[model samples]
Target: MRTPPTIPAHLPRLAARFDLSSEDLGNCAERCAARVQRLADLWSHAGTPPGQVMRTLRRTAKRHSVYMPQKDSAAECINRMSDPAWWRRALRKRFRAVELHAIQTGAVHRHASPYVSAKALRRHELNAARLAAQMDGLEAINQTTGEAVPMSDLIEASLANPANRRAALMARIKGIETSALAKSHVGLFLTITCPSRMHPRHSMSGAPNAAYDGTYPGRAHAYLSRVWSTATRRAAHLGLTAYGLRVVEPHHDACPHWHLLVFTPADQADAYADNLRAYALADSPNELGAQERRFTVKRIDPAKGSAVGYVAKYVSKSIDGEGVDFDSESDNDGRAAARRQIAWARTWGIRQFQFFGVPPITPTRELYRVSAAGLPGLALPELHQACKANDYAAWLATVEAHELRLGVDYAERESTRYRGETTKAISGLTVEGGDLTQPLSLVTRCDTWRIEPRAKGQAQAPSERAATGSDFSPWTRFNNSAPIDAKGLFPSDAPRAKTEKKGEEGETAVRGSVLHRAPLPGAGRGDWESARPAA
Candidate 1:
């Protein structure tokens, strides 16, 4: 029997090592499937000619001013996405190093987590009865190793141990807690569930009556916004706007509920909850008792872990996220309708987490660099501004706009990179810069610095450079790569070379073979080299 899977945050560093016994080897298929899916997503433009994307980029590169890098270099940048370094940079642009660091260290032991198995599910009487009748058909015995593995053991490891994902999420949650603690005296962890479906798929089985629709999330968001507004009006000093976290929840019907965390002054806590209830009642329109449990809240205990943890706890455990294949209908049906919900959510690009009115987290890239060298934050204010805007270009602007308080140990350029730096300075920055996960600006998704200090005769202003949207796109690089299959099947999608008829004389086949043709008298002689086929 495999040991139960555990989450990262809940475990200490010692317990995080990869253990194969705890892993299941069944993910091989899923890995292959995921690779195919990635290839398909990356090569979606397989049908589009490369010239179309490249033409514009080339034009932009040739016409771009001094501010713009060379056209070939720009094209090469997109081409470099195939490199590991470029992939790392891409991920770095999207996430803070500290958050990634925690995830890396926590999930250091990457192995197939034995999160699902056949024997376990078969423990139930009905399932066991069904299995006993079909035991001979399983062919569970290993052909070579002769191990009697259960058939369930071979099921693709589609579902991961929720703990593996919680590692990164919890790290960010701790950051959120730090900000909440500093900015607001009071914090509430809360949940808001969507109403029972109006026309549920399984009205008798308690499936939603009214399924999640395109307008549902918008309506829910409007209701939540109104409730928060009502709460604010009810209490002047409540400071409900101090900090807020609304994590979009995915359900079986592909709808959303939300887990939210908000901060206020301690004295206004009661007033906040009461005003919320009142708004919930008032919005009932023609509704009766309880108003559908409108909302629920709990106090945060700073002494424990973090207030942010309570709300983010469900985020990584949910089925709808980065790893899911929203387009793949073959996704496991056993995961409680997660595939359908994921597909539904994917169609809309539903955000996993959203923040409103919270103090913006600062960019610590410089801090990370400086700290890596054991230096202090010399440009704190500028860092804060860039962080507040969550813009990479703005961050570069901040890098140039400020002067640093240098010490004897400081160097001209700090060695900050996406990975492998450990210094107390970085640790301090991680503590101070909480939850930098939100997509705060356009630059947040980009790795390259779009803004540079202006030259006397600069080619383009920073704002203009930002708008140019790079004419030489990265997608054209796919032209250099092997084409992906339209159907995304492994082995099956691979390109097959055309072959000539076997009977026709061709370079592919040996003409005077020992099996059919008369053996040549000097076939093995070095002197007969001139008679070799052109191949």
Candidate 2:
């Protein structure tokens, strides 16, 4: 039995108007009640109408009751919305002091906050709920064939396997090295950074930066994105074509910077660098070290290392830290650093790596699902031969040729096609631009799955399997099984039931039978051979 929490004396009328009572407050917890009281006081102090404040509280209560219909959940919802202290504790696992401070102070309300916004966290929580449902042995039943797979298993397979992701990135890099781009173009390793004001802390000392402008990591990321867009737009106006990988990484202060491994015509590399620098310093141009640190371009020398080698560490560090030894930003080992980077990216919904001036990865993945032979009649038919051959380099060439023939901006076309889809999963590709009308769609994912709890006896616990010594060799679906087709060789030694008339005799007889039937070591042609019947 739980005790009812005591509501503040001043809030009695407000609580009464909302039809809430002390018994109902019991579910809210003392801490939650206090936070709600605090928010109510804040509302009153702001000169809000008494009726409006009551209505607002009731609305928050009702909105939250949809998911949690408990008596006290409404009060808890109010606490979640207004309490800065609660937000700090809730986000402590993923973000620290400076970041949390920014989140609490910058937002006008909890609904539209920055740096891991309420919406993003709610989305993550929903995903976590789905994952939890899967972990609870829920199976995704395919409606078509009536086949079912563990949702957890599907999730694991769909997630980017670190090793495979790194391998694919390296393969793409190698493809670029051997292509025409490598012949007439120079590889430039460019670094674009946010202004000093955006970073909250110093990189070397881990202390707050004196020039910090109190910008959240998410906002700073957006600023960097805008700057890059401006620079790229300028480059486009100059007719300077560049293509390659872009890696976004966080500074020690949680501000973002970009590392681009770009291949551009040798003659235009300097011009591209100049434009990037100009835009990078467009804001706060007079800040200390702005000129030197904002944008940097390094020309890759083939004699030193391949362009892939130059960006491999960045790719590895961002993904799984396969070949990375240390991370200077976090002062941690490769794997630990990678974990932090991934956390930062997920929290802020930032894309860590992107391939520019190439066919979008989403479309390529969709293309792989469809029959290559059938692609000749589909949109972007130039990619059909490349898909048939499974050659990435050839695909790159064909996409470029196709773009030239279409006379449409490839990036814009792909971007437009990808919009208006649900964020849950990529259903398929929508072909836009070129001769394609309005948006010709392809239905690649036709399977519909519904998650349901595992039926009794459908799955076995590991402990149960271990105790039984069960080996579903060449037949049953145990995860671990023997290679040979041997079955029933190791019979169970479960005790036999006792007879009512001769319990002791029955037990003795059963024991004797079990021992007689049990296979013994070296019983074939060794000492036990004398016990065997005549051949």
| Residue ranges of candidate 1 with Cα displaced over 4 Å | 1-166, 179-184, 195-204, 207-239, 285-289, 302-309, 319-341, 359-362, 365-535
Clashes of each: 13, 0
TM-score of each: 0.36, 0.58
The local distance difference test score of each candidate is 0.35, 0.53
User: Per-residue lDDT tens digits of candidate 2, residues 1-535?
Assistant: 2311221332333323333222333334445546656876687578766566656666654543312222243333453445433433333223322233433233211123312334334444555554455444755454434755543343332323355456556666666765645357788999989888776556665554567656767788899889988889999998888889889987755678999988888888898888888898899999889888888888898878788788888888887776688877666678766765665677666899888886565565444434333332343665644543435666677666445222111111121112221113333455555444454444333333455677865544434544765422111111111111112111221112111222221111110121111111110111111111123
List candidate 2 segments past 4 Å from native.
1-98, 102-136, 180-183, 373-385, 388-390, 402-443, 456-535
| lDDT value, residue 378 of candidate 1 | 42
Q: Which ten residues in a row have the lowest lDDT in candidate 1?
A: 514-523
lDDT of 1 by residue, 57-110 (tens): 344323311012223432342343323433332322222122222222222111
Assess the local accuracy of residue 413 in candidate 1 as a C-alpha lDDT between 0 and 100.
Answer: 20
